[model samples]
Target: MHPMLNIAIRAVRRAGNLIVKNYEIVSTVKINQPNIKNITNSVKIELEKLIIDVIRKSYPEHNIITEMHGKIIGSNKDIKWTIDPLDCISNFLKCLPNFSISITLTMKNRTEIAVIYAPILNEIFSAVRGQGAQLNGYRLRCSNAVDLKGTILAIGYLLSLQQDNQKYITKINQIFKHNYIDFRRTGSVGLDMAYVAAGRVDGYFYIGLKPWNFSAGELLVRESGGLITDFNGNHTNSNNIIAANPHVLKSILLKIRNI
Candidate 1:
């Protein structure tokens, strides 16, 4: 195992223990309670601190980027860690068991290692740059669906509605019109992409996501024999992202290209 990957696993597992404890407490409360927001927010902040502490202890010279902390620069500029301490906060607050902790390490602007831990599910999806992705300790592979027929897709929503909402919806509808079995709107990008890597879902796509939303999942998909591209099937643009095995991805791109 890579030393950095080991540290990341340690950090998320420690944070996951805290999250699970709080998850049980939140489960006892009604989602409508005012304090529910406060509790979950507190956990998120605390988890961020805990994860950063663990990383800083191991590599004091590496930079860090996080949703809560923005960016914490260290001596090393080429190596940086991107973290989403708590992904899918809405699901966590609602006790939906779909949230995750996402951590990615990049060197020279290329992802070197990625880890996404779903504490509620006790599953860890991880990948090293050249190595294949793994769920727990087992290898992962994307579904080999040759085309869209009978394939189940995972769709993620943007954090906010974009100006081209109508066009996005039109594309989704047209894609659905193809012979897919059904589509799921999971609202959790980390887990959705992890599912794609593990073949739980055939493919995943979302628009207007930031780097932290897909960095870890991006590495996982690629290591699992999948492809990531924009609506027009260009790898250069990731603002509007699509991920799937080669066959499904090509088919999806064709469906949405002219829309």
Candidate 2:
């Protein structure tokens, strides 16, 4: 493994450990609302701190962008680390065991390393630019499903549904009207992309995601022999994502474009 990727894995593992340790006591802690809880917030904050500390200790010059802390600039402008300390906060609060810790390292605007660790499941998904993706050190490959019929597709709501309600409803209707493909909302976009890389799902798409949410997963999909692009079939970034194998990607893109 590249030295930077090794350090990323270590940081993710540390955060995962902290999350698993506090999982059982989640309910005992106070709840703030339907999706927010004191315990989950505290855990996410602590995990972010832990990950940042680890990165800084090894590469103090690298910049950082995290869900909890927003952005931290560093002297080295060539490198930036994007992190989602807790990818599925609601799942964690509900004790659903579907949450993950995601990290991505980009150099000169190009992703160089990626890691997504699901601690409760002891599954680690990682990738290095120009290299292949992995699951627990084993090579990974995306599904080769060609058609939508009998295939499972994954979709998620935009961050702000109110602002994109008409588009969202139209897209949903178009997808369901086919009645040939099945879909799911996994709550965790990071995990959904990971599943696409691992061939656990045929494809995944979502809109209005931040860099940290899709950074690592995008690299994973690409390195795992999958195709990824924005809604218009352009190069993917943080805005909107559609990832799958070549065949499935084409099929889904055609449907999305017409909608």
Candidate 3:
């Protein structure tokens, strides 16, 4: 195992342990508990701190980017860690068991290692740049889907206050015009892409995902024999991501190109 990958695994597992502990409390507490929102938010902040702590201890010179605190610059500009300590906050607060923790290490503008852990499921998805993706100790391969028909898909969104929700609704309608089997909006882009890499879902697409949101997932999909591209089939800008096996990716691009 790469030394950086080992550190990332340790950081994510530690974060996952924190998530598991707080999850139990949130699950048993009443939904209407006073300041529940504040409690959850505090947990998210602490979780990011824990992850950053682990990374800083190992490599104090490496830069860090996190969801809660944005970016922390270290002496080394070429190497950075991107972290989403808690993905799918809504699901976690709802006790839905669909949230996850994501950590990615990049060097010289390229992803080198990625780790995502779903504490409730006790599943860890990881990948090294040249190595294949893995779930636990086993290797992963994306579904060899050649067409959209009968394939499950995952979609996510990070809508701004002024963004039109109906526009995305129309886009979803356009996608369903094809004969795809089903769709899931898991509220977690990281897990959605990991699922694509794991073949748990055939494909995943999302709009407005920031670097920290999909950095880990992007490498996982690529290392697992999948492709991550924009709506127009370009891999340059990934803010709008579509992930699938090669053939299915092209098919999806065709399906939603005009929408």
Q: Write the per-residue lDDT of candidate 1 for residues 84-168, one digit (tens) a residue.
A: 8888888888889989999999999999999999998999999999999999999999998999999989987664676666678
Quantify all predictions' global Cα lDDT against the true fold: 0.90, 0.86, 0.87
Q: What is the lDDT of residue 104 in candidate 2?
A: 91
Better of 1 and 3 by TM-score: 1
Candidate 3: which stretches are off by over 4 Å?
Answer: 31-34, 159-164, 178-180
Top TM-score: which candidate number?
Answer: 1
- Rank order (by TM-score, best first): 1, 3, 2
- Residue 17 displacement (Å), model 1: 0.5
- Looking at candidate 1, the ten consecutive residues that score lowest on lDDT are 157-166
User: Would you give me the overall lDDT of model 3?
Assistant: 0.87
lDDT of 1: 0.90
Cα displacement (Å) at residue 254, model 3: 1.1
Model 2 C-alpha lDDT per residue in residues 66-163, reported as the tens digit of each score? 87788888999999999889887888877888889999999999999999999989999999999899999999999978777678888876666566
* Candidate achieving the largest lDDT: 1
Pairwise lDDT winner, candidates 1 and 2? 1
Residue 151 shift from truth in candidate 3, angstroms: 0.5
